[model samples]
Target: MVGYALALALPNGKFDIAHAARTPGDPVRRRPRGNALRKPAGILVVREADMDELGWYPNVETPEAR
Candidate 1:
């Protein structure tokens, strides 16, 4: 199974998940509809194991040092 994270950027300079799935293939089933903040500003795909190290916040922007 693969892990996926879908983040949408908010007008307030923050990010939120539009949808998430761990299915064997195609994590996202349907395209998200656009909203006032605009839909699907960012999409991130991460291995299940790496999620612990990478963290969940897509807007955080982790440093290379880690």
Candidate 2:
């Protein structure tokens, strides 16, 4: 199964991923509609192995091979 790591930027200059959830396909479309009332989140598609934890990856150039 496919999964994602989702996190939102907080006003205190930190990220919040306490609400980690699973969604299919487009990450943007998967976000809750009420998210507009909160900080926008950052999403990255990940494999099942990577789903064990919640984390953030910023400005990553993700190619199958780096």
Which has the greatest lDDT?
Answer: 2
Kindly state the number of residue pairs that clash in model 2. Answer: 0
What is the alpha-carbon RMSD of candidate 1 to the true structure?
A: 12.3
Q: Candidate 1 at 44: error in angstroms?
A: 7.9
In the predicted model 1, the residue pairs found to clash are none
Question: What's the TM-score of every candidate structure?
Answer: 0.19, 0.22
lDDT of candidate model 1 versus the reference:
0.36
Clashing residue pairs for model 2: none
Which tens-of-lDDT digit does each residue in 1-66 have in candidate 2?
A: 122333433332233332324444444563453243234474333222335464457646659538
Per-residue lDDT value at 26 in model 1: 42
Model 2 segments more than 4 A misplaced: 1-20, 32-34, 37-66
